[model samples]
Target: MNYKVDPGLYALGHPDADSPVFISANFKMSFDHLRTSLNDGRSGWILVLDTDGINVWCAAGKGTFGTEELAKRIESSGLAGVVKHRTVIVPQLGAPGVSAREVQKRSGFKVVYGPVRAADLPDFLDAGMKAAPGMRIKTFETGERMSLVPVEIVHAVKNLVWVLPFVILLSGFSGRGAFLSHALQFGSVSVIGLLTAIAAGCVITPMLLPWLPGRAFSLKGVWPGIVCAALFLFVRDVLWGLHPAGALETFAWVLVIPAVSAYLAMNFTGCSTFTSLSGVKKEMKWAVPAQIAAVALGAVLWVTSIFV
Candidate 1:
């Protein structure tokens, strides 16, 4: 049980002749959650189709969760020999990629669409039914909304390290006191600015997705960045002791913070429920150039502030 199974066939809790067979993506998180959701109680066969570490929705979109992979995995796993039933229950989100008829033709097994979430598998099996509307529909509730933050934070940290040395170097060139003190202050401001942008793009905007007033992810991320920049400028200049330069520096940051965050957030389109490939391509056409301009402007202003 502790060993890593190949991303094909897994037997959970010793399934018998009558046990149900479930199909899921090969992504570690998907497999782990599915097994955990069973809680050592269910007797079933889990057919993990190779999705190349991608979750169901994305894999489905990219055709990794297609009929061919499903059929191949089923045949190679020798699943037909283990189970009496010729049925495999698949996640509803994967329906777009898989042709059930083709899978049945190729693999000799009928495919049944299951509930949207792995947690609902037990009840779904107990009921012995097809997916209901609620089971098929994707929902981004509070709990689901919170889970995406860690990945975003990790990516941010990795990228932040690359930019940190430059920030320190710039801060050191800014003033005459202890280099460490100035570096620390600059680092703090930069981190605050980065985290604020992340919160705006990844957390707040997504949570308020419907009300964010944008069709594209860039626009969605931009609104939050604008609000966060306003608040940040207010707190840093009005309340805190820091003094930013003229309107240029202020305007530059207002553009820069959100632009970077928006670019990062736009990358999430591949993982989101609403984003399409065509849409993301279109948004990137405009978003990428805008981001570059904003960052360049901010860098220029920051450098100018030291001299003037």
Candidate 2:
């Protein structure tokens, strides 16, 4: 579904020309957040810029919530005629894309950066448009990190769906009869390994982000992948006495799980406040190739184990 609002100026609670004008991305969630934060009987004008349904921080990074868009939106929306004040409040997260000097130079409107979050807008407005130090600092707390997990899991599952069938079919390759039995035996262990990788990358990595060993998310994810692999192997071989995998398959999974986990954990770079666009790009350049190589090697070893 389309999750974007129309890009234009919207009035809230009978706002007049003198009311404060808040800048927002056209993503419905971003627009809604800004509007809801001002729901305490405060009237204002929201100028929504086209961000292609992306939130303020991401849109800013992508250059959609930028100076050119801000200037064009101001002119197109007839904002100057509607509002007497020459000031517009942009969200602090969007500061990366919007150059205040360039915006003012182009549109003749001063850009006042709002708080890091929309929830702080009321206090910022009440303080005569001055933000407290705490309001400016962006935080990536545990709750926010946890909130991003479900989407990651959804994406991981989507990728796994196409890959799982091929893996299951491969597990049955014994060059003999009884394909179903072999598939059930070896395939179940492979499925466990894949699921463990998903949990390591999508859940454990994000939850233990602060305490994780490395700065790069992919590297940080390795610890969880290793721990999950060890635990899964232990439960299967020792606790359950269900050692269906041979030596090669066991070693293959130990390599594959961490590689998959690292790749999946790298996806969280977009959702994290700790990484910059350049940093993400740099990490991906090396990490993607490494993850691919590891997974390919592991897959070869796993398939070879079935025949040998």
Candidate 3:
């Protein structure tokens, strides 16, 4: 649980009292990146704060990397005694939780907001500790979005453990054909469809957010889900060696697959760079209700289709 580093001052290289000090959260990855960025003979001091292993931006938002913690760390680390200068550079993302004036008042250390990206730290520091406009911007590029895919997949798998089994058991209750064989047939189809939907929402849509055709994360996710549904339907005959899905099966997938996908995609807002707190709330106000309706309708149709 403690995915954090020791909270204190760490030296990038041997330095005198004149060396510059930078502030960061104690997340190992964040600490590592900060240290790695400073590896090119740019000697400095890094003052780490306990953020429970979360990145600076997230920790700041959560208040773990805020004013009080920063002030406390400054006092506890004996930073006053280590340096001649009193200025400490902090990531701009932490501005939400840290008041520059308050940190200075308590710790006698002036706080300068650094660039938004840690990779820009060298340039930021070299430019007399001034951050360029570009350095302050947060862009949700493809690579950034793709970075969250592993976590998304892990969440999906946890749910699928129970969901897939439930689908298999329910499919056995279908009125047509031998129960076990029918379950196997329906379950296989369900598994592929569900997994496709999850990937569409959680992986594909996020990676292609800008081009996916909607402002809402839920809507963006649906585009991929629809495509996956169609592909699954088209290949059903060849893949399953069974007859094509009937009207109900097709309708069910069309509704539920994208609905579930949308739900999961919307949940990604917490990790997304593009979304705002208000925007997500407004989107969910209308979207959650609609998604629930779609999933419910799909379930009803699927059940009725078994006997019909």
Candidate 4:
């Protein structure tokens, strides 16, 4: 099958009267994984609910994966006319947004809550299964932690471009050394620092999420960022030998790196099962201003070091 992970209704081979009907969110990755997991020659109907490109859980919380959307999509896809069964299996995490009673009332189709992970779908279908306690639970495993990095990197790069030129310009103003060399050096350091920051937020923090000593993602990210910055400084001093103005540059980065990384990690609240809107809002109120201050202060110090 030449299956592409599109965000719409797709029939996986020829679904028969006994074939199962699966529902998933419109997010490409989610849809793709669902289909890929079912590649063992099972025929089914995949009805993708439009969740505005968000995964099932987040979209469910936002009500994008609610009863109304499901009802509408079922009607538009002509699913009622095509399928012999009136049962649709939905991801368990989407339970918050969808009211099974309401969906049944509106569309005459009963909603069955499926396993938490897509990989369990085949077993789930074969056993004529109810959601096991394990299947109903969500866990952020190492693989899940790693997958978030690509999107975070993409977002960070866009922001980095805007900040890079200014960092380079400031490097020249910071010293009487060869301006071009200093600028280039500054750019390199800035990129390294930013990439480190992204890794701290998107990779390390999430992998160590349970072990990270904080209730907030910002705080969770800060621990790794600070550790990463300290290790970077130690290595730089030992290997490259610090320049006369290197201490100031290092100090600025220690503060700046963690702040940026923490802020970015905080954004991952949307992806997490632990975060609530009220909790995220509260964290942002404190974390955002603190990050801005740290970045501003770091910039000021770096510029001042040039004059001194």
Candidate 5:
């Protein structure tokens, strides 16, 4: 969805020249949330910077919410005329890309980082823009993580499309009956197993992140992925009254499912509030190579399962 507003200054509830100015991305949801949260009883001037329809945290990480964008927006929005104060409140999460000192030097307006959540804006502004200790602390509460599930699912499903054709071709070779007779059935089961593995990583792992055993999402995701793979095999055995493929097929599942799940789980680091940019980079260095190795080996195993 293209949720974006024109990049400029917006007045919330008849904001006057003396009203506080808040900096935010042009994503409509981010803009709406900030305005709605602050609309309780106070008036404010909102300076929306173009982040190409992305949320503040992501845009900030992507550099769209950097010093240049904020400085340019401040100038283009005519914020000087709209607000009397020289300081603008920026979201705390946006600090990674934006240098407060640089913004000040360029825009001649001081940047003050506000609370992490927009809901805390009322208290923050009411207290003369002094953020409480709790406001500065970043949190990824259950609801916030849950809200991200849909987008993750969509991204994962897009990548899974490539697996479909491979799945159909591979499973057909492993089937016992005439190729055409069992290809569809075997392909269907493989797809189910693949999707289950993905869900175990994308949905189950993220939902139970706090309780999951490991700090590394890849490790945490592997456990559920293994369980999902096992269950798929068990279900096929029980329903079809036949051994699903052979040792090679089981070996392939052992590698592929967890590998896929680990990869999907790793993607969550980008969405997390706790993981540092440098930490994510370091983790990816080792984790990506391992995941690639496992996936490549598993694909080879699956292809060879029919002949060997």
Candidate 6:
């Protein structure tokens, strides 16, 4: 979706020099949210910062919404001439990147942090720019967590398009029945295993995030991966009446599924409010290599199972 707006000053509803100046990221969604919140007969000047189309929270973590950008945008946009008040209200989520003192020292404007949610902006402004305790708190409710699932599913499907065919082709090399027959039998099972891992990572893990055991996302995801693996084995060995897989193939999948799920779950850190930039970096340093090693070893074991 195209969600970028130009970075500059935008006037909302014929703002005057006495109107308040609000700071925001140039993302279309961020700008729209701010404007919509102020539509209740309030007038203001929105100074949109260049954040490369990212929303405020993420942009702040990446440093795109930092003090330098805010100061530069204020100067370049001639904000001092447009507003009589020297104060600019920045969203609370953008606080990570911005230093209020630094911005004031550089741009000659005082920075006032607004509420965590734009929906509360009207009340915050009417209450003499004071944020209630509730407005300062950020929550990752069920709806917010589930909203990120579709993006993960889309990414999994894209990767599967190529990996699935390769897996099926390799299945034909098993020294058993006719090539096509072996491919259909073994490859179908492999596909099911892959789908189960995807569901565990992209859906089940996120759905059970809060209750999942561990603060680290990778560790939390392992529980769901284990559950999905058991379910897949049940369907394959009992319900489908397919030939039971060899010990090597079964063991390989046990390692591979959890690793895949953990990696995908770790990616969710970027989309969630529960993690910080530093924390994510620390997690990836150990988690990524471990995941790679697990998947590689699993692949070798699976290939060896075919001939033996």
lDDT of 1 at 160: 72
Better of 3 and 4 by lDDT: 3
Q: Name the best candidate (by TM-score).
A: 3
The model with the greater TM-score, 2 or 3, is 3
Writing each residue's lDDT as its tens digit, candidate 5 over 67-169 gives: 9999998888788877777999999989988999999999999999999999999898879889999999988888888888899999999989987987787
The residue-level lDDT of candidate 2 at 225 comes to 91
lDDT of 3 by residue, 64-144 (tens): 989999999999999999999999999888898899999999999999998888899889888988888899998888888
lDDT of 4 at 257: 79
Which residue ranges in model 6 land beyond 4 Å of their true spot? 238-240, 277-290
Candidate 5 Cα lDDT to native:
0.85
Off by over 4 Å in 2: 174-177, 237-241, 281-286
lDDT of 3 at 186: 78
Clashing pairs in 1: none
Candidate 1 lDDT by residue in tens digits, 147-182: 777787677677877877777777665557787877
lDDT of 4 by residue, 1-308 (tens): 33323455688988876678889988887898888999998899999998887888888989998898999888888888888889999888899899999999999899999998999988888878676678878887777766876887788778888987777777665456688886777556656777787778777887888899989899998999998887766665555444633667777878887988798889888767667889999999999999999988987776676667
Q: Give the Cα lDDT of each candidate.
A: 0.78, 0.90, 0.87, 0.81, 0.85, 0.91
TM-score of 2: 0.92
Candidate 5 residue 257 Cα shift, in angstroms, is 1.0
Model with the higher lDDT, candidate 2 or 4: 2
Instruction: For candidate 6, list the clashing residue pairs, or say none.
Output: none
Instruction: Rank by lDDT, highest first.
Output: 6, 2, 3, 5, 4, 1
Q: How far is candidate 6 from the true structure (C-alpha RMSD, Å)?
A: 2.3
Better of 1 and 6 by TM-score: 6
Please give the lDDT score at residue 165 for candidate 3: 76
Error of 2 at 88 (Å): 0.8
Per-candidate RMSD, Å: 3.1, 2.2, 1.5, 3.2, 2.3, 2.3
TM-score of each: 0.84, 0.92, 0.96, 0.85, 0.90, 0.90
